[model samples]
Target: MSIPLDIAALGERAAAMIEELGAISQSPDTLTRFFLTPEHRRAADLVGRWMREAGLDVTEDALGTVRGHWHPAGEEAPRLLIGSHIDTVAEAGKYDGCMGVILAILALEAVTRVGLSRPYGIDVLAFGDEEGTRFPTTLSASAAVAGIFSPANLTMRDADGISYRDALIAYGKNPDDIPAAAYDPDKVIAYVEAHIEQGPVLEAENEPLGVVTAIAGASRLSVTVTGEAGHAGTVPMRMRHDALLGAAEMALAVERIAKADRHGMVATVGRMHIDPGSVNVIPSRVVFTVDLRSGSDTSRRDALTRFEREAHRIAAQRQLSVVISAFHEVATVPCYPDLQLRLRRSITDVDRRAVAMPSGAGHDGQAMSKLCPIGMLFVRCRGGISHNPAEFAAPLDMGLAAAALVRFIERFNLPHLENNTTGAET
Candidate 1:
């Protein structure tokens, strides 16, 4: 028998928890929790307290990831991992990564209340380093859990010149213990997460929730345009070989190529630096960064090629030398097919059609995918805004998400829904 789901109560509890966690931020006015900071330590302690209250065995790992384990099937059974990060970007919204951890706790709390029994166990993880805002590394916490963490990352430094290794030591952790944080891949079932859509797609489609099709691939490039610096007032427009002008045109080329791609593609020239910064100077050199993302790797590669050609052509026409170098690149990670079908069914059980979409934002699932099959559920937020103070999701929608996750947990045997008999027996 399915236990009755009180979405209103669930949502209210989730909202209360979110408010509590949102208060533990470094900034007095905005949320700015970073990895291994004092704010993060407080936040992790709070999460650990909640996990223990929810009837789970709470523990903190070497990287400070808080783990809440519920294992009715014994310690040797395979495990289902559900999690999201707790770190935040500067001036971040409360619901981006925090909601996922909150929803997992609520859903599992419900399961525990009913004493649901299964062949496997569940681990609710609250990772500490997804934002990558502190150190020069993102997903290091998840990478450690997935057994893909590189020791070289320990040498990476933060803005305050603190090495990641030193930060870990200061945080009361031993770097050598990180290896024990990794779970045996053979004993793991899969990883799942529930996060806000972080975009306008679900709101535009009038859906409360979405099933992520894939986490989009991303490529970052640094482009440099070199030309002669001359007196801005004396150089005639026709004779001037301005590097800024070439860069401006190249940025437009990036937009045009992305716009024309069949796959959903977005590109941005988010940062730029001009040498000999002066209002009267002609700007001899311009350096800018391009962030390109697409659901299709083939299409993303094609767009990059086209952008390179356009950059060189524009530079040649303007008599400027250009150089393009890739700094970061990650391929797309698709949701497991079986998990997708199961998650879609669970949404249908909530009486809402799940909108299938691609996540333009990066997630820890990209790292966890190396360990096991991965899936994600996206809840709709107001105005499709994220990484800002204005970010919000309706309490009822979050409640519905909790209820849907319960339904998913109830039917996690990876069999046809009709054939699955186990449920949240009340």
Candidate 2:
């Protein structure tokens, strides 16, 4: 028998869970629940209980991904995977990654309550460390499942020099057994993630739901401008070898290059440091980090190359030397067309005017898209604010997203929705 899905109840559950988890503070305004931390463990335990209450068999992988399964009775069932990361960025809002996990659980609850069963199994996964707030690597948990995480990744250290492997051991998990956490590619039929828009696109469009078409790729670069340090007051304007001035010119150049492309291209210089920053000192060294992102790889590469060239020209004009280094770079990820179509259908099934758009922010869905077909559903966030305490989403929009997800699960023939009469009751 198919279960009756209650969209309102599921959305309320998700909102409540968000409020509950948001109260666990690692900082005054920011949430710092790093992967394998006690706070993270507590959050995982809470989600596990919720999963159990929803009649799902729950387990945690070696890498700390929490899996909740609702199996159908037959052996020939395909698996439908749904979930998002539970980790948050420093000073991040409540809805970023955690909302998706909460929604997944609520979807399962609604499906079970309604006695909905499918021919395939459904799995709700709460992936760990997608934010990379403490660690340097992103998608730590999902990468493990995709068999992309290497032993080298386990050795990565946080800002405080704490190795991820040591942190796992401290949490009573074995880092050496990471291979055990990998999922068989043949077992996963599809993966879906529901997340906040994170940008103002949805809210600006006055839309409640965003059906994601693609995830923008990102490239991070660190530029260093070197010039002679001299007396600020004594040096003449023309003779001044100010590193900061050169860097400033390069920064403006980056902005211009991005503006020129204008096809969803963006560049930001979020981190900058002027050495010998004293008010009276002429800066001899200036280092800054550049973040470039675009939906097209060609555009991203073109922007990056332009920025570097402009930096070199500015340095030469100022009689300074500039060096550029790659901090990190991820290529553009195109969502699977079939999966995107499925999500669009589900969204339209719920709301006829649901809009299809590209995701500017990075997500675990992008990483998962590499291994299997992946789709994303986005709810409108207030002012599209995220990664801050003031981030928010309307309750009605949340409900709309939940309703769409539940409908998607129903239509997808997910395996976890099947009735496993022979298995012990969960």
Candidate 3:
């Protein structure tokens, strides 16, 4: 991927930034940066320094999202938002959420160096908490910027019983000041995120980049199965009401139904626990977590209803009681047609093999949809692996992504930029 002589330096810079941020993890053994922790704050500070070096003024919000502002002609043109989260899932890879921010910086840096005159400005945002590993709420940082931050979210707690409000204060910011983070949407065009594919589709198709059609919505469930505990020797197999058995039946049913759906539905039972662990004792209780996602909200909800109904039936047949609770549900965000067309053109200019695909993963764009149009570009990742130590994206792919982004920026346009400022930003 031989790029233009002047902007080619950005590709190497993107790879180096990924490595630098990967080393700033909480654990010395694996990369594990979380929200509002010391590591996250440190990452914000580093991002500010890099933003300054790129000739952009910097700011940090109450949620610790780092903002780098760039003006092509030192005028207040419509702002073009480009960035991803710096926070990571447990044992996360280098490029899951962080790559978008770094690659944005690199692309904007090239624009800054070349003094390209444009009608829109560029803002590189390093969002603070997209992974939701510690806070249990994803896209909270970008939601704040979009002016959609819910007051109820502050009441949420972490695994260690820390409230998000308290965590905000401990992170050295005023929880009451989140409203100040809101930006004027009329001053912007749209939001764009460059990220790793985080799936095998691009590799399977032998393409380096894909323009996202839409991001899937998610519904999270916690299920419990309860039954009587008894001595294994005293209770015959036919007489025992085993909760674990019922749970196993329900889990298999979830897989079977999800595989039957045609709209790319994916259901996962990622976490589970079985009680009464003694080898001689019949299992008394079981708890498991379900994560269901798809491109259509109706389809996702229908799948959920079917799974829950079948789980209850299985529990009744096994003489066990079942309970299910939904803790979170985020709506799907479709890519606005204007931005999608522009992104498709950008991808075509960079590589003729680019295609359009749906993202099964949720992103900050889901939260930012309330503010403006959103588009995304995905670089191929090794084996479609993410949120792990083994996840990786090639430097050549980063270059390819940078080229696409540069093309997108050069063709940047919105109704507001051509005439009056558009409303409904924050």
- The candidate scoring highest on TM-score is 1
Residue range 1-426, candidate 2, lDDT tens digits: 334555566667678889888776667556767787887888888889989998899999998899999886554456778999888877778998888888888878778777776777888999878988888788878888777786787788888898988999988898778888877767778778999998898888888898877788789999999998988889999999899999999989988998898558888999999998999889999999999988778888888888888888899899999999997988777666676777888788777677878788988876676557777888999998988888998777787787787778777753332121111110
Residue 111 in model 2: lDDT: 81
Model 3 stretches with alpha carbons more than 4 Å out:
1-9, 73-75, 134-136, 152-172, 226-240, 316-321, 415-426
| Cα lDDT computed for each candidate against the true fold | 0.91, 0.81, 0.84
For residue 198, give model 3's deviation from the true position in Å: 2.3
What RMSD does each model have against the real structure?
5.0, 6.1, 4.2
> Each candidate's TM vs. the true structure?
0.93, 0.88, 0.86
- Steric clashes per prediction: 0, 14, 1
Candidate of highest lDDT: 1
The global Cα lDDT (0 to 1) of model 1 is 0.91
Q: Which whole-number lDDT from 0 to 100 does residue 127 have in model 1?
A: 98
Quote the positional error of residue 273 for candidate 2 in Å: 2.1
Worst 10 residues of 1 by lDDT: 417-426
